[model samples]
Target chain A: MKSSRPPMPQLLEQVARSLAARKDPALTGIDVETLCAQLRERPPPPPAQPRWQDALIEAQIPEGASVLDLGCGGGELLHRLIRDKSVRGQGVEIDFEAVSQCLTLGVPVLQTNLDEGLREFPDQSFDYVVLEETVQTLHQPLRVLNDVLRVGRYGIVSFPNFGSWRVRLSLAIEGRMPSTPALPYRWYETPNIHLFTLLDFLELTSEISARVVRGFSLVEGVVRPLGLNDNLEADESLLIITRDPPLA
Target chain B: MKARLRKYDPPNSPTSVGWTKAFTWRLTPPDTPWQLECGGHLNEVTVEYETYGELSPARDNAILIAHALSGDAHVAGWDRDASDTHRPWRKNKPGWWDAVVGPGKAIDTRTFFVICANVLGGCYGTTGPRSICPETGRRYGLSFPKVTVGDWVRLQARLLDHLGIERLHGVVGGSLGGQQAIEWAMAFPERVARCIVLAASPRLSAQGLAFNAVGRYSIMNDPLFLNGDYEDGQGPDAGLAAARMLAHITYLSESGMHQKFGRRRRVAHGPKSGFGVEFEVESYLEYQGRAFVERFDADAYLYITRAMDYYDCAESWGGGDLATACRRVRAEMLIVSFSSDWLYPRAQCRDFAIHLCRAGRPVTYVDVPSNLGHDAFLVETDAVGRLISAFFNPARKGWSI
Candidate 1:
């Protein structure tokens, strides 16, 4: 997906143009072209990719498809989908502040807890149900997963992998609950009540008679193909859950 | 000079719409009588309505606000002609919902044309129990036909037609008004684009019915009630005061009352209050009751509360099934319930949203946390206003962070 943030060159040019046009006494001594050159000579930033949101878009959801986002935080992903993919999106968020943000983003949202399940939605009501990075925080993650799959044909879920090497190393060496970039919380203050690895999630799908159509390992903010040791290597996992397994 | 200042001055807010006047429209004439849901008809009906802001050229920006029990058409702005209109109750303050309906407020008067009308059975400047019956040439005190929430919506549609508004951008209300808002979507599926129902349910609860029954009983048992034909200003003041006092208790939560009054005694008075006012809470309720009797009509109260009691969305729209009833709504729905509002409650509003969803309607439900009970919809302006303004104009960039 295209980033709304302008590239470095375009941003610098915009700043330079504004500076050159200004007649303010304080800015008169500043040279616009020199500033632009100084800013651009720095190391080029990495390509903006591998956010769970970007990974979800890579799943190639059809244009104008109906999307329901459970626990849509400030509706950033849903808004991105609507703007870029022209998808009709709805969001369910439990926080009022986040719900207000979703409204301002022009995404239809309901303020509801996920633990209660998506009983408001009819069966197969949407083309895709995205539960990004919210499964572990729920009291009944399995129950919500069942409902998510029941409500939409495809369920795209992303969560922090507890089996990541960094987390394991932290726990083993320090002898305390681990805190990584993905699960950045102390034991008592953590919102993540249920912790599971990538393999545990894949196992959960099979137990519920669901199948994983696609899986991505996101390590250090880079998306990679699911690997044999991904359960211990990946920081986060993204999966496309469906009712039937993929063709051989 | 004091009365002049009170009647003519606008509110202190810069966004105030200034002073407003109530306008009368002959909505139903003798030839085109309004049909009632209770199998009755009324002819030569007049409606008192007030409008704020300009209608968009496309006429789609009109929002009709339905008032709750004891509310009137003066929904925003100070009533300039309150004395002339004989609605002295409106002179001292701006509209009941002034907090949320100003130029830059939630239901922004700058962008949307806001219209509020006194209900058909209302006491304030509308054809109610106080209005003379065109056929009998007498006041329709006990004679007024039992009106329903459906009747109110149908009449509102007629008012819209008279105003040349083909469709509404939105309809909003709290309590009884919220029920009307829902009824608008169900009754005129093609007319409304959005509907916001706050602090209301599909029907009044059994406990609510019990309270209304006792209030009506108080009014009826009064000697001055005189079978609803007594002279004006001499009819059931005591009974009406008692009724208002009882109903006011239901509109506030125990926590709110505790925070406001606690168990503290009135410090100014001695402790020798046998049945008189000793507790501050008692004095507050007495003032509320006395103030209500000065403004509202006992007969209109009976009709309105009865109408509220009779409202069953499933029974009226569906054949005893809520999901079937929900299918009639075509507008996007926003249902809000205050957390401490036992009068309507959050659970019932959630059920309403669930049914709407089951019927394939696009709905958003929020339970706003407040200890103000049902009154929170009116008092908790900042939170409610943000939610409303965002709902109405979603997708606008640079909304407050």
Candidate 2:
């Protein structure tokens, strides 16, 4: 299908310029100073304090252990871990801007959606796979949990406890969606899709034959020992689970 | 340091390597038979390479640059003459990626020692189809046992070992070269510190294999081929030319063709055309094919394309599992793909990137927009070079700049 037309005007112009120019555009190489200027324009994110989940997980993670944080938003907690705990911190964040922010902070982060599962990694590649305040927002929480346990030696699962007394009271008495400090979203525009309580999460781990290594309960941003009615009283809950090794 | 079609240099004419020098490594290790993927073995193999810049005292800043199909060891600059006259390839030819491999360019020879080697089953100085077979005392020609990407990678590792380089700062390559880079990182994980893979995937696509199959068929069906036994003045020039033309098509973008050649014919006079080249693209392809026929060996083409086709790094390492195969890699990976490369396609490279990520390996994947097709890595200089330098900042590691 060859027609008898002349070379395109754009093509002719480019060739003419290419022939006339001494320093070809393709060979001019990047300007390091310009890159530095551009990078300076977007200053690194301000320093921030660690999340409550960081303290909860930090107590268990040994120094120099490899830790991967799934749904690591802006990688702040991972940055703190790398800085203070002497751990190798890697993060998988879904948000593009958040990943860029992480890069600015010098925290290693990969962009990927958690709902699709962590099928990219081999078995037990990391010491810990953490999902802080993010599991309830996932599309396939069960499959993601399986993936977390498959890749990391220890899996840390933390979420806002939906069965907390405040949430229960808000829903039952006021007949409105809970607006607690942790679950800071309206009913119509909330990202928390499969929200579950501490009791429900425990039941799930047991159903899958997962061995519970440790647990934590936080009420009103403060770490508190779980009582008999922890599911109803606690605002936030965390668990450490070790998956039984796959069949040989 | 421009990326352009090299000016015509007469074959056998004196030439000069403008920016770099070359060397040779004899790959003969005791008890290791230089085993290849297709069950072939070479006892004594010679590898020709070009080195740039000075190596660090710690020997940690060495980077291996793998050449693509039809590419030789002359990656940057031109060597007019080699002290080793036994080498049969042109020494003075300008390097394929000269713009990207210079002193302050993307790979930046000023900061790291760069090593570019001619691959096995190539027509260059390496032990390939044109090299003399020790047993027969003649050229290997078609007798050169089929080689694979795995063979290229293994022989390269031996060459590095001979150089006393315990570990490489990075393994960098594009196209077929990228395949070797991935294999190096996967097979000899401890040796490679980083992988700079541009426009490459872990395995060849079905369509890519089909394209290569057509090229092989064209060569094998030629009357002058004589089952790859043709020599001297008698060779399969026509078949090889056709194969090169086919390959050239895959290396170009539709947008590029439309922008550059379009429906443009070679001549504007009254139409009385019969069978000759009518369009500009046709003429360009013909010239490319003829120039390639003058330089490349037909037998080498058959073996190398087959090697590229047979390459399945994931299957070779972990028995059909990609993630498991990549688990051994210790180097951080930087993967780049072009938008116009329909040949390798973004989906394939993206899948590879995703696997690297899932394996918990450090990776940064960039999809750059371009009209240069598969050759964008070689041509889209300013943008690609900046991306590479930014991604490969050794400044953070406290390496002396």
Q: Which predicted model would earn the best DockQ?
A: 1
Model 2, span B256-292: residue lDDT tens: 8788788777786748659888888888889888878
Expressed as tens digits, the lDDT of each residue in B83-190 for candidate 1 is 845767776778888878988888889999999988988888777888899899999888988999998888889889888999998899999999999899888989
**Global Cα lDDT for candidate 2:** 0.76
lDDT of each: 0.81, 0.76
Off by over 4 Å in 1: A1-51, A83-86, A245-248, B1-13, B28-31, B394-401
Q: lDDT, candidate 1, residue A30?
A: 49
How well does chain A score by TM in each candidate?
0.77, 0.75
Off by over 4 Å in 2: A1-80, A83-88, A93-248, B1-18, B28-37, B82-93, B267-272, B397-401
| DockQ of candidate 1, scored on C-alphas against the true complex (2 decimals) | 0.23
Model 2 chain B scores worst on lDDT over the 10 consecutive residues at B8-17
